[model samples]
Target: MKIGELVKQYGVSVDTIRFYEKQQLLSPSARSDAGYRLYSNADSQRLGFILRAKSVGFSLQQIRELLLIEDNKAAWQCADVKDKVQLKMQDIRQQIAELEQFYQALAKLDQACCGGALSATECSILTALEQGKPAQPETHQEDASC
Candidate 1:
């Protein structure tokens, strides 16, 4: 099939498909006499695999590694694939923990402000910031007075 057909079937932009080609993730099986890219059924299945891997947060490099493993399934063990998934899960967990810390810090700052028509000079949040005080998660006070 042609590139346009593949784009319509996948619901992805032309640039996205072209970028995948540039990234060496997906390649057309052939080129038409008119210089248009033509894909085979195998290429369509490969594209699907790439898209699904991306949706699951796999980086392009990681997807490349996965594709290599997939292409040579006889040379790779199931344990190898499981190890990659476990590593990705660990990375995601660490990111979530860091984001939670950021959220807690922002929440503490938000709760410190009364949201009244007070002047900026009397803002406790600003005072805390000016003092270079680090957000202590254990010291979340409920007082909303500025």
Candidate 2:
């Protein structure tokens, strides 16, 4: 099939497929007499894999590494693939933890303010920010009203 066919079938832009080709993530199986790129079923499957990996947050580099392992599956152990997934999971967990901390800090700052129609100069939230007061949850009192 031609590149246009892939675009229609995959619901991705032509540029996206071209970029993947440029990145060595996807390639045409052959070129037509008129110089159009021709892809095989295997190429379509590879594109599907690339899209699925991206949907799950895999970087292009990570997808490339995964494709390398997949291409040489006989030479690799299942543990190798599992290890990569585990590392990604750990990274996501760390990001979640950091986000949770930020949420707690913001919640503290939010609770410190009454969300009233007070002037900006009298706003507790703005005051905390201007004073460089840290929004550490432990240091903030939930009962404190603006």
For all predicted structures, in order, the TM-scores are 0.84, 0.81
Looking at model 1, residue 139 earns an lDDT score of 38
**TM-score, structure 1 vs. true:** 0.84
- Look at candidate 2 and tell me the lDDT of residue 52: 93
Which stretches of model 2 miss by more than 4 angstroms?
Answer: 135-146
lDDT of 2 by residue, 1-146 (tens): 99999999999999999999999999999999999999999999999999999998788999999999988999999999999899888888999999999898888888777665545565677778889896433333444445
Q: List the residue pairs that clash in candidate 1.
A: none
